[model samples]
Target: MTNNKTSEVPVQDPGADAVSESVIQLIRQHYTLDARRIRRIYAGLGSRNWVVYTPQETYFVKEFISSEDAQKGKRSIEVATHCITSGIASPSTVANRAGEHLTLLEDGGLALFSYVHSDEQIDKFSIDMMAAAGVNLADTHRALSRYTAPGEDETDEWLDMDVAEIVETVDEILGEISKLDQTSEFDEVSRRLLQDRKVQLANYSRLIEPIRILTRGVIHGDYGQKNLIVDDTQCLWVIDFGSADIFLPAYELGRAAFPPENFDHDDWLDRGLSMIKSYALRGALTRQNLVFCARAWLVQLLQSVYGVKQHYLKPHELQEDLDLFWLRRGKATATLFESLEEVEASIERIL
Candidate 1:
């Protein structure tokens, strides 16, 4: 289902002309720069990114998908600023003439930032790179330790899944699966995966309580090789705080070590231990933290299985292609879940 096409210039979307005009006007009015070219970058989820080339310099423009994300975008900028001040390599937000980080757009919000010339090659990440990623994340955590949100009552969209919420979600998914015809392989796999996850949730329900007592902080919600950018100078820069949230450090560490998608490497256990060691040098990681890490990994797999099931249930133009995609993902999740005990044991030994 993935496209393998590579082009120097991105193909224009249907509204490219109108969007280009609006971008130009926004830039001229606010930043006082004339845009020469604007090309869309379709990499991340939920946001429309465009790389704008102006006569002065190149910049990155991010357009939020919803109005609510406008506030989140602003907060991300604030957190990134704090990270940069704490000596972490992060992109700096470019304020407008009015000294505002966010610009109101017709549908949502737009923010401009200095374009970072970095490469995000997740498949090419070596153990050394993983260790470096771990160290970078630790530094980020240390920098963000003192951060206090401007609004005390603000809700984070990237909250960790709790036992009650997970149970409720599984119940809803089971109900939806029961209504399905189950004629296709995708449907069968969905039902099986959901059933397996429900059992896993019940078995691991006790770990969630102790996780609540662990050290908490603001963390990069979507920490992974893809979100990490290795610049031309080989300095690693963390990007995309769209999913930033305040949660137990163990959850972040676990999510970072065990991403939803499987990688090409087979030595994940070693790489994960290296990351944990590097992070432990800067922060704390108790045995309970490792337990929470395993639980977090299971939670992410459950979410992935649910997401793929939902996609399969919904009628899509590329349902035929997506059938294979979801099937492979389901199989991978099942395989990982079956051998999760080994991974957890390894983490425990390291701790």
Candidate 2:
């Protein structure tokens, strides 16, 4: 939710001319509006997003980068439709003149949707807002409970990671870290954290057994403040279903609770529990689920570290700042993990 500005800014890509021409062509051919202006929206890690403004109405367009991702985009729209019919606040898809939800691009796919105007000030979310978000999340889960994907069979694989898979991932990350030259500060810190994560995973290996049996369903893959939008009428609309997949419900809850922006908040724990309690009122959230929440927090921390490691391996111009950022995040995550026991106890009382 950073760097979100809605102005008449040009697209960042150097090939903006060609891209805009193609998009304009799509709009003119498929829709009934004179495209007035278009500006890129800097949100989400996946997909190139743009806000297309017309004299009649505005639209949000997404251009997928891969065929598999395009398929997911199609599935996401279907999921959103189900959620909408179930009374969840989500965006409505804007199909082309051909009556198709997706426009197949050469490399991937494209889709247009009704633009949702929202406040991007996630850091300013009030306690009531947090609680509301929790309730909506539960509502989303309940609505998705009855969702059966088209052509879905036993052979369809969902994007879920079990404890065993997480453990294997830990080993792989550690091995990758060890192979790096330990000269730079980033390398040194990454190696140290990776080693510690290996130990932590070993200690908490037993917790995985209970987590595997928790409530599983279609969850908003990246549910957090970033994906939420407060519409003109103050209704919160959840967007960006690109990562939607079948997974433990607790994963979504935990992701919402441990967003990096909330790390420094004084009453984050209280607010997080309040959201959890609100969610429980609409859906099932047991003490066992709270345990998995703690585990989820740890996993998020490890994932952050792994992300930093990946950045270190890649060639980027902001290498200096990236290392500093990783160090700071590493320290914060380590500090949180140290106090996780106390955090878990407090969350337990709420249950």
Candidate 3:
């Protein structure tokens, strides 16, 4: 946890040259790859990612962060492989030079992921898709039951949201704001949120309940649409365990609701419930725990409110930060919150 602001990611360089080259070589060694003809495809805007293209096969290449940041990425790949091996629609790791899913390149860390051929349309997030996601996620959790975090020496729980970390993130964001040279626009509410974070940090303890470890398993810490690759066949190919972890179900559920600002609110809520019900259908979710899952959304929203306030929306993105979270204002914390409340209430009614 460096003091670098929330604006400055711990792993700043996404595509290190050495890592990228190593990844290309590794893929060529292990898979059917056209080393000279490989071209980079733009799959995601955030990460320094490249899609390797060949006549017969296509795969993904990514330069990860430094050693410290690469651990999570490595854990995510391991977790996904476990799920695939256990029959989940998960992509397997192709070749990791460091034996761990990551290898240190001259510029930074690098890893290769199986590129899924996806043509699945972004349908209006429906109950069916949600439920499928949930059931699949439960299966993911079940599969991860045997896996553990890759690095043995690291003691910090990746799933646990530490107060110190929150404070650190806040401080880092503010520092970045100071560096931005344009403070007048963000001066008003952002300042208030920064000052109030001290209170939020204090109140974080009051919000704790007995953590529901519904099942002990590896979690795709960032389990949502952006991370999943759905093929034309409608098969869900889970990828990017960069934010993956070995932790409780509650942690995974909470993280699911905190998507970037541009994501659809209705889709977020509906899919959330679908995931819960799917887990329930698989006997992974119990009635009482479902109520807890609902509460988990609230807790997640609360934390996200803090995070959204701290982190700057993508410069190129259209929606304003507060507008995205307008629902979670005086009465609304996030646009997604009310729908979540309804979902939770629905669960309670059934109970």
Most accurate candidate by lDDT: 2
For residues 80-193, could you state the per-residue lDDT of candidate 3 as single tens digits?
A: 676677787766655643355556555455566667776645552456666666667777766665565432311134325676866776676666666766676445455555
Question: In model 1, which range of ten residues has the least summed lDDT?
Answer: 1-10
| Overall lDDT per candidate, in order of appearance | 0.66, 0.68, 0.54
Better of 1 and 3 by lDDT: 1
Report the lDDT tens digits of candidate 1 across residue range 21-56.
Answer: 676667778876676677666554456677878778
Report lDDT (Cα) of residue 25, candidate 2: 68
Residue 18, candidate 2: alpha-carbon lDDT: 71
- Pairs with steric clashes in candidate 2: none
